[model samples]
Target: MPPNINNTTQLAQNSDKMAAPISPEETLARFEELSVLEAEFEDAELELIRKSTALNEPLWKKRAEIVAKIPHFWTLVLEQIPVELETFIQPTDFQLFANSLQTIEVSRFEIDDPKGSPRSFSIKFGFDDNEYFFNKELEKKFWYRKSKDWAGLVSEPVKIVWKKGKDLTEGLTDAAYDLAQAKKTLAKTSGGKSKAKAEASLPEYKTLASKIEDDTEGAPSFFTWFGFVSSYRWISAEESEEADKEEKTRLEKLKRGEKLDDDEDEDDEDDDADYQETEVFPQGDECATLLAEDVWPSALRYFKQAHEADDEELSEIDVDDMDQDDSDGEIDIRGLVSKGRTSSTSPPSKKQRKA
Candidate 1:
């Protein structure tokens, strides 16, 4: 009787030993599941990246288009700017704006209208050797009806005047208008009296723009008549006071033996290069979110997950681990499964080191 009992005990032990830990196929299946999750994440990240790139393109295009118009604006404002422009113009400035405009190839012109004289928002033209300008809401008249589908037609043609054109005067407004919203931004950065002065001169600047234009083009629109107008304003009395030291030093240099060549003598390099107004499509919050903030992390996460899954890192736990006696005597199916993945019999890098 004792021998039979021992034999029965031994048989039970053998049976327990024979029970499988986990099948190789099940482990592979878990890895495949991880791969799938990673794949989905990867696809989402890639799509998001594409969307981000698309988002920035429009802004770049807008900026490029608007920058193209800078020369026309600078020409209009050259003589009128209260402070003389800095004479130095390196190639970098041209590359930044005017050069870029020639690439977009948009048709542009200005004309005169009754809404106002060649000021504020009207247009003008030149006949023999004279230039013209104007101040008018320039609207691109699109002939969408030519496309042959009534539903296909866009409701409004592409039209642009100045930025928020309402809060401006006739003579000074064109400077602000031609620059789009840059003068406001510049004034804000400059602050106090300078800002006030810029605000004051907006009407006169606008009037100035309405007068001059690039005469090569045909009859211009009230909007196009103003080739372009710079929003740069005078150095205030305070600014002149502040520059006294620098001017004194320059004068001393001249007295000592420096020859001062006047600007009028130099063939001015219409240095319209570095001037950037609000017209340029600028990347700030929206662009940063799409390009750097949103897509790459998601992509990297998915890529790393796929790599770990491919290496069979989740194969350490088996069914017996799930079946192990619990402290509370409760069956914990969740203990057997890990994040809904349960088939691995091998180990991850962290677990392998311990093994």
Candidate 2:
């Protein structure tokens, strides 16, 4: 009855049920995290981009100039955005220390338990101010394991990710005031703002919503997630803006019911096609800028798709008859390892025989 929602995109999304589910809080956090962590990610992504632009900056003098652009970019960004209070050179407890200042050192070492997609790294780095030397490992976050390999002098790029975080609380002090003022303005004008006063007080760390109370849904909702056609329209509008202005000047002919030119119609169709292509993957690159908005309605834009898929899978699973082996707790998972257990009856292997 719903007009047969079976389409290529719907089929694709259904097939991609394995994608991870993301929460509204997490989405809001990610958007904020991007802003908060942008300096680091941008520096990182730019280093990669600059490495691509190496030939553009062929000479050492130019290389230094190009490389110098990095810190300068940050300086410009901080100045324009008024978001960052200050920055300093320090490693986050979670970030790799590259006093060595060369990411090349990181690429040289092997991860401890190397697997299929072995992500190796090095440890030595050198900078004008200092050099960092490390042994053994670095750290791990989520699925990526960070490990330090062999130490060396400053021979290569350090793959340094300054893990340091900012006291967004300080930088956002003004933002909080502005947002609060906006709320008061909205309250007096809309009368709806005070209804959720307690929630309005709830904080949104990475999003404008954080400045507001959580009583309201803010920008996150389910309708937003499944509804991404707006993104396609946005991209189409973007590519058409400049041309649209010019076309408006030529509108007298069009308004007279004059025949449209083949070129103009084709160009319009092309713009529409580009937008359509962009719509295929809402979470792809086109939507990246959307993450920079004041409020990124997380639940509407993202969900832990994988977790939802897993739950869907588990629902179809007929494990109801299965009984837990443990008399207490969920299950004594150790029971499954009985054959590998070190009991008095079984002798240890040669590897452990020495022990």
Candidate 3:
């Protein structure tokens, strides 16, 4: 009876020894699960980087475009502005001071023929120490559109005298009708101004009058006659004042010896290069809308998570110890596993090892 009892106790001890808290298969499965998680993390991280780059490219381009174009618009104002206000200054004085216009380093423009009048060519406006510039062609189309638009915005119609026919009886008849229409419109309007003031507004009248005297055609068509109307108006004082203020600031900067940079002048290298700084017009609030501030941090977080997921162990461990092999010439899985255990059989001594 005592021997059977001892055998039963020994059998219970052996059963306890066989039971392991975590098996080799389970450890391998855990490693594989971690590997899958790491793979997913890596994919997510890569995707985040790609998204960040995609967004960054356009944002930079837009910012650069805006910086360049704003200054260029001001340059256009400088060039064609005299045509609108020619009455105020002498043509000879304007020609003499035309060279002075180049002194304002805010913009740099060149005519195709430097010696000739600047009727058509290209212009570049410099900003940010010449780090950025906007260029555009100054063709007839631009001039025509810009003139009409500017006239509409800045001037009120004072008079419109259509050029009459060149033939004797027909010319007198058309002149009479146009004069009557002008008087009627003038009478209906509330403003009471001198005829001289009204006449002074109509700069186009001079052109139409010259054309009519020179033209041999009898009676011009309505389409052709419409071009002869001497439309004119007083310039908007408020808009002029605003523009003058900016121009004054630029001039003062010039007086202070603030020169524009020319180191990155692509114009010197390539004549046909596109210098048109197409803008992304940014209003005060709209400027903030373009920022990629949120996405970059999210990308970094994803990258960090990917790196963290690849680590084999959750707890602190000596990397040097991990690289060293155990007596069996295998990485010690016990050290890699989490701290949890149950009784298990041990390996045999060196002398008792299998051949």
Candidate 4:
């Protein structure tokens, strides 16, 4: 038969066989080492995020600048020349406008009730050099409502073909090529150098993504509800799987007595616990009383002894009168001898006889 599982009392009696507990100083030193490692890991993670954001900023800014120049190109075609001379105007006129455009203003309006549709609402925004196009001061009149109604109409609308830009298209192509080359160069550099390069090229304007495609028509605004361009740091499933495989291989190698780096050993050691800690109720609640007549007699006895000890301390006079006096606080020598003699039914010993 298997050896009996000892109760808390037996374990306490035999506790001398167990190893001595670790010193408080050693425990504190280990905790401090872990804290330093945690801080370093956090700093490294933060730096990665900062680098990715820096690289993505310039790409978005250049795109915004390109979108901003679009207004002037159309302005030259429809407004600068007479209507009769519209057909004679070459595509080069737009190219010049696009190339020369340094800056432009864009306005937005929310119309609660636009003409031809009072029940419905609409949002209108785009680049228009002349304020007269949006009813001169319609933005001001509907400022409280944040709506610019059709009452602000001041000029005839002009048609713009979004398809062709001649030399401006070539310029965009060159800019894209240059940006791509710069990105490739940055990618080649290790760590912080790449971030520095990207930060240097960042534009002054806040860059927002328009996700504009050449196919998009009748969209005069540089802004769109589509989305924005940003950088992300994430691990793919394949990469995660690879990392797990690497860890398993390193552990196997270590188990086979192969020399491995200190980091690998530390990682493996961290995965294990120095002790198995658990909470157990030796004597369960009232519900357990129906399961067994004496569900945990030993635990009940232990607790009873503890409670009696407390009672004895509180009622020291009542206990001491029946006990013997001693220099020790808890040694009830006379009480113990009397109880033993009463239970044994044997003849008194020399010590008892003398007492």
Candidate 5:
């Protein structure tokens, strides 16, 4: 009876030990569950964005009407843009914007599209008859997309159609546009072969590559963003949907405790490595995001900041002028009177009082 009791106690201890440790597969399954919850949270965030966009539309239109009456409204707002965006704006670019950039508008172009994301937005720059471009309005659309290798907002290069001798981007936009178009042509001609294999065959690619290499300018103009493509390569809607399906299948397998092929990750890495390098406006997405999220919604705040900056500059100039006056032996009677009042023990002389 004592031996039997000890065996049962040992079995109970073994059971406790086994139950205390979780298998790697089980841990991975739990992580996948958390991922699903995170995806749900993202969906909720998108819904909130859609709701807020609807609410803000009327206010934006009203603000636009009021802003139209204010001279250099867009210019002031842009001037007070965050330093992150300021880096891209060259002196020439600012001058152009100040002269011609009348109105800036942002719209969630895909807000109502069931197939499209609310995150997808279009930035429209309304210009007065400018020497730089013929177009009264230049609009750039960014699509929120996902691919097997990368995911974010992707945009095709916009043709600026620059006026003669007034090209701010120094032919960078033209070159970028040409290069993108050439790639598309080549891709179709070469039966979707690797771009690298056919890149040398395209004169447009060489021209852009030469331009990029010859560029001594530390940072390209903000206008170059008009020709902005993806930070990675451009992924079309169809490709994005296919990638989404593939990812869903992968995740489903992960949830089912299936071992994923190591080669799958390697293939993804290879795809990333194949991304075309664009030195021209590599931070385009970031700049676009800043314009859409920060600059657009808070234009009034930025306009106020611009005014505040002007006030600060004026105050600084006043102080400097006062210092200069003092250096030149000029006396301020008001300051003298104030000092006299503060130090009641010392009475002003008749000569000082008169002054």
Candidate 6:
């Protein structure tokens, strides 16, 4: 203004100053604040789950007793599972569910544990002397855990102990169990060294890999879920706790504007690069979550849905038959009478006659 500068020029200069790039430090600080907020939200969610689980315990038990008396109740409920889970259930699996599946229950097994997560749960399946497996009750548990590079539900393969020639999974479960045992043995013998260094030497591992590759079936059996492991590498509870603590410490330092060492960052990258190679049931976690969250809590609704579907099918068939009869210029008077419909040939009602 002192030098007769144009007002438009001054305004444009001010806009340019306002549009200056954010410093990396400021950007990182903002990101850290958001990360902390996300963590708080997660903690809140877990607290709510814990509270709800307690409130629903007695109700779940009562519901289980009621459904147990209804023949094929679990089977019908399973049939109404989401398509993502339905795709994994082969024809053989359905047969097992229909014939022998007696009861299905989902429980938050670790809800009370201080270190454990309310999100951790188990799927328990009861069978009535099934021809498939030796276990009368099969329960698969999933632990909500965190590792350095990954986190979520992790489970050890539940051994099915199949009857001779009755394994619905076609030996996949057996092979998976063997491989897991072999790895455990190897880990103990090798004094905590990485199992991958000598995994190729293990016969159990090779056999399972070959079996998985040679499978010609369109989809693996739902029973194979008993052999499911973590989506990433399996981490023990102790290891998970250690990793969680370390992560919390790292985040604290990040929030305080402390720079992470270059070497530590490089090491973390290397750890992430070591991906787990074997995956018996990749969608097992999703299936387990669906069973726990949707199928378990809403069993009655799903059962009703199944019945509604059957009724709709029958109604459609009746409509189609009626159309065919009309097209043929014939009417089934008995059919109309059975459905409580008056035939055209019937005499007029008293009200109609009066009109």
Q: How many residue pairs clash in each candidate?
A: 45, 37, 0, 2, 0, 0
Cα misplacement distance, residue 86 of candidate 6 (Å):
0.8
TM-score of 4: 0.16
Count clashing residue pairs in model 5. Answer: 0
Task: Determine which window of 10 residues in candidate 2 has minimal summed lDDT.
Answer: 149-158
RMSD, candidate 5, Å? 13.4
TM-scores, in order shown? Answer: 0.17, 0.15, 0.15, 0.16, 0.76, 0.78
What lDDT, from 0 to 1, does candidate 2 have?
A: 0.28
Report lDDT (Cα) of residue 162, candidate 1.
32
Can you write out model 6's per-residue Cα lDDT over 181-232, one digit (the tens) per residue?
A: 8888887788554446576568987788778878865677789889888777
Task: Supply candidate 3's per-residue lDDT for 36.
Answer: 45
For model 5, the stretches where C-alpha displacement exceeds 4 angstroms are: 1-23, 193-196, 251-274, 311-355
Instruction: Highest TM-score: give the candidate number.
Output: 6
Q: Mind giving the per-residue lDDT tens digits that candidate 3 earns over 193-280?
A: 3533443244333333444455554322211221122122222334344434543443454345454232232332222322111111
lDDT of 5 by residue, 1-355 (tens): 0021111211222236457756554555555666556566778999999999989999999999999998778888887777888887776566577567889999999988876789899999999987788988899999988876567888988888899998888999998888888877777777544546566557887787778778875667789899888877677787778777876676676567676553354443335333455546777888999999999999999988765554444323222222223422223322221222232233323231233
Better candidate by TM-score, 4 or 5: 5
Q: After superposition, how far is residue 12 of candidate 5 from its true place, in Å?
A: 30
In candidate 6, how many Å is residue 290 off? Answer: 1.1
Candidate 1 residues lying further than 4 Å off, grouped into runs, are 1-182, 189-228, 231-245, 256-273, 276-355
| TM-score of model 3 vs. true structure | 0.15
Between candidates 1 and 2, which one is better according to TM-score?
Answer: 1
Evaluation by lDDT, superior candidate among 3 and 6:
6
Tell me the deviation in Å of residue 206 in model 5: 1.5
Model 4: number of backbone collisions: 2
lDDT of 1 at 349: 50
- CA lDDT scores, all candidates in order: 0.30, 0.28, 0.29, 0.29, 0.72, 0.71
Worst 10 residues of 5 by lDDT: 1-10
lDDT of 2 by residue, 1-355 (tens): 1121111111222225677666554454344333334335534763563353343324424434543433222112211221121121111200212112221111213222332112222222223332222222222111112111111111111122222342312222334334444544554665332233432443431343333233232222111111122232222122334443444433444345444342343322323233222122233222222222211222111223322332344324333212233322222111221223233433323242233
lDDT of 4 by residue, 291-321 (tens): 1112111223433443344334432423333
